[model samples]
Target: MATYISKNLISGEEIVLTAKNHWLNFFSKDWLAYCLSSNEYVITNKRIVVKEGIISRRIVEINLSKIESVTVNQGVFGRLLGCGSFTIIGSGGTRETFRNIDNPVKIKRAFQELVS
Candidate 1:
């Protein structure tokens, strides 16, 4: 069976479809309550992007309730191929990013629509 999690952008609520493993990981990681935010389109997670001088190697975590807006990032390859990543802004000026998901444009759009 295949499972999916269409999380609520506002409440950090989620609906699981198939895979329970990742879903559990999301909770233990505090991904739902911490890194997500509601948007008219898609949710954004913080970018654990390797900064120039950050030296702590911890597992990336995100709060799904803090997202202020969803910003899509795409290169020529991403745009041409119809995929990309997103950035999210959250409460107290926090942020996150989820990279390289399938059909990001469509997913974001779906999320935006659903949330709306």
Candidate 2:
């Protein structure tokens, strides 16, 4: 299936990186719900896009110029498992957190490369 990002890309925009929820999510209390819902984080040359849910959907898109900061948080287990959470803070003070994501540091780095 075509990704939410692909269908929405504008001229000159290309995806830099894409990340999904980590395998560790299977052990969480919301495992079943997590499995039912899909979470995606996509970074492009011009923006960051997050798509969540299955039957229902929640999408958040932030232009690179409007991003203030990206923060990664990991516990010992998460560090060992290569999964964690990243928070994106927008210029308008909007904060969005995506948790249990694989290689969150890589996502942060990808975003840094685009905005820097």
Candidate 3:
């Protein structure tokens, strides 16, 4: 999904940052398919947005104020490569996982700073 966040952006909302899918995704058996599946994360002034999917469409939005916690998991290789999965937990126990995302630490920090 080649989405132009700028075009879809709501009035008064601006993207503070953007992230792409991790390089580790290349290791999957169906690497081509993985590439076709666009996985991106966008951080705006008021919310965190994740757009991803292959067959069906999926979009997740979490208001910064409602974010309870953010967790990152990196295996040995993942840590060395600086790519991994992260889970964003919202207030009321809602959770969303973005796997094989690039620069997870930086992404987590951005979210944490905004949420705090």
Candidate 4:
């Protein structure tokens, strides 16, 4: 299926990595909402994009040059399950966190490679 990220890419931009919420998210406190909506994390050659919700949508984009750091948080179960949360901090005090996402480390590493 075509995603919000794919439809909005700028000229010469290409997707580098994509991640979705892990199955463990179904056990989260927001399980009902999680089931009803979808969340997507995407890294492109030029930026990071997060798309949330199924019907009513929220999209956040941060330029690669603006990203300052990426941090991952994982518990015992998360480590075993290969799912964790990623916190991305960008210039101008922009901070966003994606929870229960699969392969958080891979996502972080991809972003780091793009910016570095």
Best-fitting candidate, scored by lDDT: 2
lDDT of 2 at 101: 93
lDDT of 4: 0.87
lDDT of 2 by residue, 1-116 (tens): 88777998999999899998888888887576468646778999999999987777889999999999999999999999999999999987999998899999999999998877
Over 4 Å off, model 4: 29-37
**Candidate 4 lDDT, 1-116, residue by residue in tens:** 77678888999999999988888778877576468646778999999999988767888899888889999999999999999999989888889988889889999999878877
What are the per-residue Cα lDDT tens digits for candidate 1 across 1-116?
22112332235444311111112223444344223321112223422111111133223333444445657788887677665666656667766665543355654454455445
Query: What would the TM-scores of all predictions be?
Result: 0.44, 0.91, 0.86, 0.90
lDDT of each candidate versus the true structure: 0.40, 0.89, 0.81, 0.87
Provide backbone clash counts, one per model.
Answer: 25, 0, 0, 0
What's model 3's lDDT at 67?
88
Name the candidate, 1 or 3, with the larger lDDT value: 3
Error of 2 at 5 (Å): 1.4
Model 4: number of clashes? 0
* Alpha carbon deviation, residue 41, candidate 4 (Å): 0.7
Ranking by lDDT: 2, 4, 3, 1
By TM-score, is 1 or 4 better? 4
